[model samples]
Target chain A: MKGSLSDSTKRVMDIKNRKWLIAGGVVGLFLLASKLLQAVELTLPRVPLADGVDVAIEWATINLAPFFDGIKLVVIKLLVAITAFFDWVPWIVWVVAVGGAAFRWLGIRTAVFFLAGLLTIVSVGLWDHAMSTIALVSTSMVLILVTGIPIGIMASRNDRFESALRPVLDAMQTMPSFVYLIPVIFLLGSGKVPAVLATMIYATPPAIRLTNLALRQVSPEIKEAARSFGATPFQMLFKVELPLAVATIMAGVNQSLMMAISMVVIASLIGAGGLGNDVLFAMSRVRVGDGFEAGLAILVLAIVVDRSTQALGQRASKETRTE
Target chain B: MAQEGAPKLSVRGLWKVFGHESTGGIVPDEIANKSKEDMREDDGAVLALKDVSFDVNEGETFVVMGLSGSGKSTLVRTLVRLIEPSYGQIIVDGDDILQYSEKELVDFRRRKTSMVFQHFGLLPHRSVLENAAWGLEVQNIPKAKRLQIARETLDLVGLSGWEDYRPGALSGGMQQRVGLARAIAADADILLMDEPFSGLDPLIRRDMQGELIRLQEHLHKTLIFITHDLAEALKLGTHIAIMRDGVVIQIGTGEEILEAPADDYVAEFVQDVRRTTVVTVRTIMDQPDLKLRQSTTPAVAMREMGQAGVVSAFVCDEEDHYLGMVSFNGAAEAKQRGDATIADAITVDEYPTLPADTSVESALPVVLEHHNEGALAVTDEEGVLVGTLLPSSVVGAMAQEAQDATDHREASAASLEASHADDQEEADGDGDSEAVDPREGMEVS
Candidate 1:
């Protein structure tokens, strides 16, 4: 099985000499193939994948209307409650509360940044829209974590479930955020509820994936130690596993929040009232100044939430390590 | 648990086999003789424990010792059912714990025994006090009471001022102390320690061993301590069990083990134990009948010395306070000169002395180099003549150690044969055992 040193050396020498020739040949083959294809008049083929999706959507809309309606009822109630709560708060109160939270979690720099960003939103006359978007993002984030964590825990407990979830999460991540609206609209029809659904669908994968990862990454030594110490399965989960996994799970929540905030603009397509709707409306009318202000408001809101949540995650991780 | 007659813990016929249930009930004869890995391949079972049986007495430190992959860790962990054994009966305080129900097992663990992990199983997120209080927390003790107990336990482990510090922030030895504190804070009757000091530097490990010995005196919790280090085992163990390939090769007191190793595996491990440092002069000291009184005549002393062989003799006072050495030639000269007593003719400066408790291993060298005058006299605290140590006796002691080892090997071989017979009988009876008994099989069918 052994190759003599000289033979191995000669093979290496041969490969080095022919490498450039091989590169040329490969390029030549690619060019020749393209030329032949060109002579054959390269054309795109039509596929019925979209039509199939449409038919499925149509069928589901008719047959699953009551099921979708039940979901819609729950979704609408939660969305309205969240939005109404934010709308009831005064603009100055919103600015102060957010600024204070940012200060507490992310330190002074982001607090200043948050206040500046909110004040700019008010100065640009998009205060109400920013509030509405914050409501949407916060509600979606809460929903994401609530649903994602349990599924993540289940996946952590079973290898098969985790494997099954990996591909679906990948697809959710790679599929365009706007494409989520197609199903959302078909099921709930254009409104804030549909937008929330779309935002949740787009943003939820990272939360689930990361939570699963956090639980799986827990050291078996620590796990065994917990069990041997007489912790019940439930106690082990709540006491040892969750505490150890908190920092990683917090990172997941931070990512979910960022994903939710980024989807706010796209959420406007289905008539969700937010900075996204303002930007959409401004763009439709070609009002550059209005578009710029609305876009700037979204950007500021994303940065403020993103920075604060990230800092919270970092703080938790550091505390865990130090303890 | 407070009973007087029952041992603190007793494990019998314990076996832990890791893998699928396909080979759970049957083990082949060749597989039994094979190494752990080969046996695993043969039957798809990692035999982590095999016929491990040992008794740990109440308030005693029973150390289980073996090198890595020697199944010592498995043996200790299986006692607590951390890594559950495939078969065994763990009796603690006259209760067969293997038959404990789910709730009963939980209660048994919470109430009966606690463990100190090799890696120092302090919760990473908990402070030193919290880690110590973890057992009580799981027991659902009230917060204030648990914290109070934790604070006291930390103090007991010599971590009084550092109670508020995180375990992660402590040194390795201190972290293990925290681990130890957790076990003690539980107030369990027994503590199972799995190489709790293996991660420490040598000095720190040694310090921890000293601390453990001191703690054991006050706590008196029946501790099943596991370690691969022979010195640690010897220093701390009241009784030690040496294990190899899941079987306990021998179990005896520290001195018994030093004097008699059960097999080559134990002999090889104990070879580097520095017996000289541990074995004392008291063990090898011989009481010869040739003690010469200071009042005895020089001519009589010469007669006694010449009778013994030819050499100097130890001449002590009537109360046995070692005074001086009396040589045969000096006694003969005194006899020729008509000296009345050996006291005047004694050679006090010639013989060197050694304390009774000096290690025979170290004392032998001193005796070999300087015993030209006579046998080295060993004295007690009051400078009284305890006995004499000779070069021959010191060499004889080593020879005795070798001979004891041979005797132990024979005993162990016999015990192994007997245990194998018992195991074969058990396997035959337990072979492919189903949930339903054969008598009940008719009903099931």
Candidate 2:
């Protein structure tokens, strides 16, 4: 191996050209194939996929749509209930809740930053939209954890299942956020329900991925020690593995919340009303000022959510480590 | 009664072959006599242990001492089924542990035996108290009660003040103590300690060894310690099994090994051991010669001393209980001064007495300090004269061990050199008189 790749110049040149070679080969083959063909159909091969999806989604909408509607009703009701509670909460209470939690978990500086950010969001007259966004993100986050953790745990214990889920999860995350809106809109047409559903599809992957990683990352030595103590598999999972993996799982949750909020702005394309809607509307009309306000509000929400959850994870891991 | 009857742990025909999948009803015949390297090359299997068997008596520290890859670790782990044996019977309390179901194995691990890991495998997220209480918690004991027991066990391990601290906050030795505290907290009858002190520095390792021995005195649990340190095995073990190349080379007390090593391998391994510290006074001591009854006259004492060609006689009671030493000069002076019995003339606590259980290393300085005086009296706990350890005897034992080891090494070294010379001469003279190694080359010339 060393003899074959001895010269540093040759190795670096090989790597540098490798990327161009792949791109050039692909482009050259396509052009060559196209030129050689007598009658070329340049219409992107749809494979009747759109119509197929349309009919399947239509059937699901007509037959199974009621079940999803029931689920949507419960979800929206829960979201609305939480939204009402937050709406009833004076803006000062949000300040205290965010600031107080930040104070203990992070520090006085983060708490002060949280307070100022909340004040700014309120001053910009986006308070109601921010509250609505918070409600949607919180609901999606809770729903993601409720479903993601068990799936993650099950996948973690089964190699074949996790392997199968890996590429599917990659597609869920990498596929355009707008792509989710199509099928979602087909099932639950043009509403907050479809929007939240799209945001959930975008956000759920991180929770499951991180939960699986956290469970796997738990020190094998501790697991063996737990076993040597005659801990039942159930007791070992709950008492040893879960507690040790808590910090990592919390990190997963923080990422999920961030994903949900970011996806919510894209989610607004399907008639979701929130600060995300403001951004969406501003983007359509090119209203720079309105877009700035809604975008800034989202930033403030991100900072508050991201910092608190991150600080909570750091605190959990630190308390276990330090004097 | 258990100690006298069935051994605490009895292993028979135990074998652990790593990276080898044996599917047939018979073990490959090559493994029966071939070297580990040969098996690894031909069969892609490592014979980690080969037909190992040993018994650990109840309440005794059974040490499995060996160099690395010698299967001592494998043997100890098999006792707990931490590493499954390929084929064997491990009997604990007359029940074959190999036949235990998963549930029964858990029960056995739960109630019968506990292990102290070499790496101090305490839960990093848990407090010292919680880590110690972990085993008890698995037993479904209530939180408060388990914590109480854990706290007491921590106190026993000298970590009482750090109960609330996490394992990461403690030093290596302290963390190791917590591992010990965890095992003892479970209150198991047997402890399988897997080189638990090997990771510590030499000083800390010695301290931990002393701590373990001190704990062993009160606990009296059956302990199987795995170590490469022969001195440690000698210091701690009531009986030791020395292993080499996955085979038990010898099984004996430290003194027994020093007195009579079973083979050259055992001799070579124990050659570097400091026999003074490794051999107890009980093994080195001879039956006391200058003995006289306490009521014997001073003239008679002087005569006994004269007969033994010593200056003193150890006076004992009628039951041969050690009273004190009566010096010939003192007794004769007492007789001149009209003293009646040797009891009155006897010197109390003369010339540094030692218990029979004390190692010669410990008794050396005391005996050498009073070398001009008669040999040190070796007594039992009941204050009876068991034997005497002379300075000459200690020196002789040390010298004899050194001589034997040096002579063996030289003899082997010379024989090897002689064979090489003969081979060189043969190759130069006839070019084919010596048998050619098939592994070296095919052509004899």
Candidate 3:
């Protein structure tokens, strides 16, 4: 029985192999014919989409200057207000407040590290630049999270929306951060506005993508259980899906924060002054020691933000596991 | 047995083909008529459920039993519209729920039924109290009231002390208890359980089964349970529907299914169930061949025993209450001794009498130890002699079961051959007969 079965299978395979060979031969012949007819050359045509995009951006800049200026004014005021608040506070006050939060959410080790890091910034005489960097990043993060998390929620609920948003997000992540500046510089002009906008464009994808993934990964059985109890769509999202997704979303927020910090030196080119300006100044003057001091300040800020946000995510997950 | 009044839930002509592709989304006559295999082979559509139908009366534990892939899980999910039926009517309380609008369906799900899943799908982020109260919370109940009700429900399921613990912290059986509490806390009319204990260890599974039985006794909620384990079905189900290949082959009481399986498939499925546990003494008892009044003289009793061709006789009073067995030798000796009546000769001390409703498994040892004296007297609840049970009758009942099994196997083998011949004819004498031999081997063995 097995022998006959194998024989029939072999015959079927032979027929399939012959079919493949015939198709391959036909394709090979077509390619050979096309090569022989290469005298009739095919020329490519250009559509000039780049010129069209330039025209569109110029039109928007000319026509929507008032709306763009209003946005610019609001962002500048917000950034100035935050920077003023940081400037008004004594360094000890900032240290005590950030250190207290670190202690409560994380533990003594993180708190001590944050305090030591803050003292190092003060000792390096970069306290003002560090505070400006913190202000700019925090404001950009607020904008990123407010818009990105909701977009993530919407994308998570609908497949077509996610599919449409996927390529846009891919472009946002992969295109050079300088590419974002060309358009922002044309419309809003270079300043704190373009700097914050560029930072947002750079930092928002991780939040949206990770939030979508986290919501999708909140176990199907848990969703079904919620549905079986007749939870309305809104209740299911808020009570079940969001609560389960929060930890991963916190990780997304941490990524966004780190991305925002990575943009500080880049943002400095657009007159968003901070430690990044210090680094850029040092580089322009060929002062390696000054560059290292500025870089160390950014590093300290990144570590503090990364550790705090990760601890928060871990706490959320631990709550779900052993509440 | 309490099938009084209208049924609480009715399902008629339910069909759920997973990859259904008939035009207009209605089940096509051709696909519906074709066998499950033919439908899959021809159309690439799986027939997950095929014309399934059953009624669940109020407070009845209607168990759907099948092996894995037999669509028992699908049937339970379809009850709550978790998986929409490809076609059918699900009538609950005079309302065909298939016709319910979105709002009405939501209301129905909220108020009329609750489902327990095989995986004990509790929310991991929630405490046991909040998990149990989730059904109420979704309905927009106030927190205080819902928590109070959840507390009562957890207590009912014997989890009162652990209400504040997270579900991840509980053992599997206890987690399922929380699952049960969550379902019961909804207070719906019908409860659907889809193999809720199948994931537990054997010992915990048995414990949960007992817990469910106790809860059902107290609550009396209508239950539709699904399980692949036939033993679990028999133990918990008031009525069982045995399914095979997306079709319900039989629906009956446990004893009925055991005694008369509906088809070869059902018979094969039930072949390993220990029959003694399900078969009762009353089912196997026999009419007493001889009877004597206690007032009869020893000579007369002796003559009666002789005439009846028996070693002993059951002596009863005028009211037909069983007295004892009187052997022919004892009667003859009594007659020689000039005893006035067989009452003096009759002795009640030898054999233990069994109630008519005792299970055969419980009666086997009693009969084995005492059959030499005479047949054991089978009495009713009133102590009136109803029938007799002997060693031969026990053996005969079991032997008849074995004989019927062998006969079924032979019949099945014959039918298999006939079908194989038909297939060959349809294939136009194609020499592809090897595929049918393995099934033939299975049936014969």
Candidate 4:
């Protein structure tokens, strides 16, 4: 009796005593790393693989060019097509999508703000450009999720691979968005493709990092319960782990979408036309009214994507808890 | 009911080792070169389950009782191939299940067995009915038919009207019942429950246990239940297997385990059992002596029974049919009522009655429920009393058994220590032995 404690009591005490300090340390480290990287645009010099590797570099760049160019053309063509289709569809569809999401997540007041934001953008005559911006953001998100989730799953499955990739992910996330354009432009040249490539590099870290974090955070008890009931490893991942990690991964997607949207204006430097191009053109021409209108359009687009994804994430988490 | 056939499930020499280096080196030369202990120690492996074996008979409640980390969970998991054993074979319905392919394993799981998890792994996105139909759906059953079956199963588990609610809206016990209903709906021959009631409150746990027993009585499915609680094991198990450190220490009927534990660990388990309820009249019944003088008076009956050192007197009719039982206190209380007629004065229905065939476990709940001093054993269907049981006698028998076990354990420990001391003394008598010679003035306290 003196030494005995019920299993649940011990488990509760263990949870209460869990090391939240480690989480704090990780956040502090991230902030410090970000500040340091920002303070010094530190770049490591690349050594050529051979004595006369200039020819190889040119050959490699030439070889990789067609693929990047093809990707660029496809992305821009898809964006233009989506924008044209948006003009045909009633504006009410966009409003409903945005408003419905807001109502689900943050209720009526937020839903009103969502409608008001869209109305403000359209009233300022940037509706077409905003729709174009939405196309770009959605495209980038779909691409990132497709690539990032598998990579995250691989990283979670292998400790050495995950550890090796951790610092690379951190560097990509912390480095300036401008740095992505340098290599992307060299490979694909200035276009929507280079712009999307840069945005993908900048926005992808959260998806991978959060996927890994969420999978690791799943309780061992839940996993054991699944296994005890004859769930195969694949079944455990698809049925239990994936469902449980849906909220966190969706949050990652939301962050990626926001980052992608933020990169659109920066991406305009390479002829990635959208509301970003309008904002850049208006600013350079010193047209304050035009710049404000484009800026408002971007803001509206950001809010719509952010709210909808947030709503979806909340619904997923709520469903998980109910199950 | 015991069936005259092979067991439904049989596991033999099962071993599950995690993180073992030698697992990949299964070549004959390598295995022959390495000793078992050397391989085990050098590989730094954890033997989650070791040389464990058990057979679960058809239509019987088989309980695997062990504390956490005792390999009870591991053993159960291996039965379903959830955690595949490194060695040993599992035979289900007389076929080796270890040879099953991926598709075959899935088929086996869906058709032959279904499991209830402790945490109630209901699909959160699905409604209760949908969750219940999950297993049937996995088997490729059509949606409409599966839903109908799921609804019926939900009704069976007492969730008939709550089909639309998700698992979160329900309480913990209700969720577990949903888990049970889902397993039952699968219509598998074997039901494997891994500590299903462990998470519920005590009252709910008892209710669920009762529900399981009731369901089992009607359906007669083979059940493999795992629990750490000895009380639950005794209550639910037709046969209990007590495990320790990845090994089954004992496997027998509940009475065999409680009455005759294999070792100290199991003795400690049953030490705190409520002996008055667990012990039965059949276990301590004395033969009837008809030659004794018949005293119908309550006061006379009390004196005669007390003098005879019996806890109760079995009253019989002229045809030797059991009429009723009168305990010493019942007779004494009757005398205090100031009624001269013995039939009017004596308290006839003071104790519960059961047939001799009733299990100690089944009788326990009845006795405890009624708060009866004892139970009477009857022979005929018309409640003909055969013998009387005293609560005090059951307690005395349990106390005596416990004392004997304790004394035996102490004696064994003493003998072991004495043998060790003797060995040390003999070693000290050697001339080359390093000995601390006692000083003449030193007291040998």
TM-score for each candidate, following the candidate numbering:
0.77, 0.80, 0.78, 0.72
RMSD of each: 12.4, 10.2, 9.0, 15.2
Per-candidate Cα lDDT values, in order, are 0.80, 0.81, 0.85, 0.74
lDDT of 4 by residue, B181-265 (tens): 8899989899999888877766677789878988998989999999876677767888999987677999998778877999987
Give the per-residue lDDT of model 2 (tens digit) for B12-81: 8777788765331234566667777887898788888888888888899999987666788778777777
Per-residue CA lDDT of model 4 for A1-323, tens digit only, reads 64466777888777766766677789999999998888676688877656455565567578877776678787777666766777677677877886886787688999899899988877777777777777777777777998899888888788998999999998988998776666666778787777778788889988998898888877676565445444666777887789888998899888888889999899888767889999899989999988988887888788877877788898889887743
Q: What is the lDDT of residue B154 in candidate 2?
A: 94
Candidate 1 displacement at residue A303 in angstroms: 1.0
Winner on lDDT (1 vs 2): 2
**Candidate 4 CAPRI classification by DockQ:** incorrect
Candidate 1 runs further than 4 Å off: A1-13, A17-55, A100-108, B1-6, B22-37, B40-45, B280-445
By DockQ rank, best first, the candidates go 3, 1, 2, 4
Pairs of colliding residues, candidate 3: none
Evaluate residue B114 in candidate 1 and report its C-alpha lDDT on the 0 to 100 scale: 90
- In order of TM-score, best first, we have 2, 3, 1, 4
Weakest lDDT window of 10 consecutive positions for candidate 3 chain A: A314-323
Q: Write the per-residue lDDT of candidate 2 for residues A58-95, one digit (tens) a residue.
A: 89988997898887898788788888887899988878
What does the lDDT read for residue A308 in candidate 3?
A: 79
Candidate 4 residues lying further than 4 Å off, grouped into runs, are A1-57, A90-108, A157-161, A215-241, A282-293, B1-4, B21-41, B285-354, B359-445
Which one wins by TM-score: 1 or 4?
1
Each candidate's chain B TM-score?
Answer: 0.67, 0.80, 0.73, 0.69
Lowest summed lDDT over 10 consecutive residues: which window, candidate 2 chain A?
A314-323
